[model samples]
Target: MKVKLYMATKSAKQQASIIGLLFAIVCFMSCQRSSNNLGVTENMEKDKTDVAEKIVLTDEEWKRRLTPEQYRILRQKGTERAFTNEMKHLGKGSFVCAGCESELFVSDTKYDSGCGWPSFYDTVDKNNITQELDSSFSMKRIEVLCSRCGGHLGHIFNDGPQPTGLRYCINGGAIKFQKDDEDNK
Candidate 1:
């Protein structure tokens, strides 16, 4: 009976070790996967102009420049309620950074992602934006920021349409649309 009890204990220890090994393997494999899709390197240097011309403002200055909602999303990294942006249907303009008036996205890239916020497949210029690994709220995501002002625009995801399977899920409050002349006509 003692022998059987000892064998049972040994088997339990082996099971625990196997479970631990499996957990470690999963974590290691996940870490191997690249979190960024746009090829923004983990240590990529910002452009000289982007660095030199960056918009730096104090909280009071930002408050003065942006609307309350814009201040929340751009400066505070807060999110607007999904589908709440009035500019979603503007259809023909470039979206500029609310904080710095830097063009961040064009209307041509806009699409209905049904994620409740404005979604774009591409940016007006790659140099206008930057990305960072976001691990907030117990989830891992790629956070998109305005390179000119370092403001939080949104998060990018791998699921998107052809040409570039990346979704720049931006907050509308962080941007202002300027209608093109053709759109005005």
Candidate 2:
């Protein structure tokens, strides 16, 4: 997914300052990817800024935009019931971050696990996720974070549905889907 950074400015200094702030925010939010096949991290070059960034939503703003169930599950670390998430049958599109609407996963990476969740073989980037130890349902699991806004997206499992052997069990409320246009492809 693309990182969107909103910049409102009245002058060059203000624009530079905003850009700097955005840089710092992105740098802090971004995680470093290890060559050892670990997971994403929060480290990168000091000045590799690109132009794909769009405006990011504030916490309060997102809360207002999303339903209580969505906010609770995606932003507040809550979980939805199994076999109930709406993204299960989702196909042929890009899944953007619900909090910011950045394209996170393409349809090609999607796979079915019959585990009542949307699974992916890989992410748009290795540093696209943050790892956490989740012990909520009296069981331990690895929690996935959006890395950009530190939003809880879902979990990762080793026993995935297919060839990649990695299941990225994402929360339905955590993302927004943009179906790919065949003509565009």
Cα lDDT listed for each candidate: 0.79, 0.65
Candidate 1 per-residue C-alpha lDDT over 1-185 given as tens digits, one digit per residue, 9 for 90 to 100:
99999999999999999998996555433422344444533444543454678989899999998889889999889887666787667868899998898999998899987677788989888889887778775556778899899888988776777677777888888988999998788
Tell me which residue pairs clash in candidate 2.
1-103, 3-53, 4-53, 4-54, 5-54, 30-42, 31-41, 31-42, 32-41, 32-42
RMSD of each: 10.7, 19.1
Q: Identify the leading candidate in terms of lDDT.
A: 1
Top candidate on TM-score is 1
TM-score of 1: 0.74
Per-residue lDDT for 34-116 in model 2, tens only? Answer: 11233322332222223344345777897898788878977788766555667755557788778767566877888766655
Work out the TM-score per prediction: 0.74, 0.63
C-alpha RMSD (angstroms) for model 2: 19.1
Q: Which stretches of candidate 2 lie over 4 Å from their true place?
A: 1-59, 161-163, 183-185
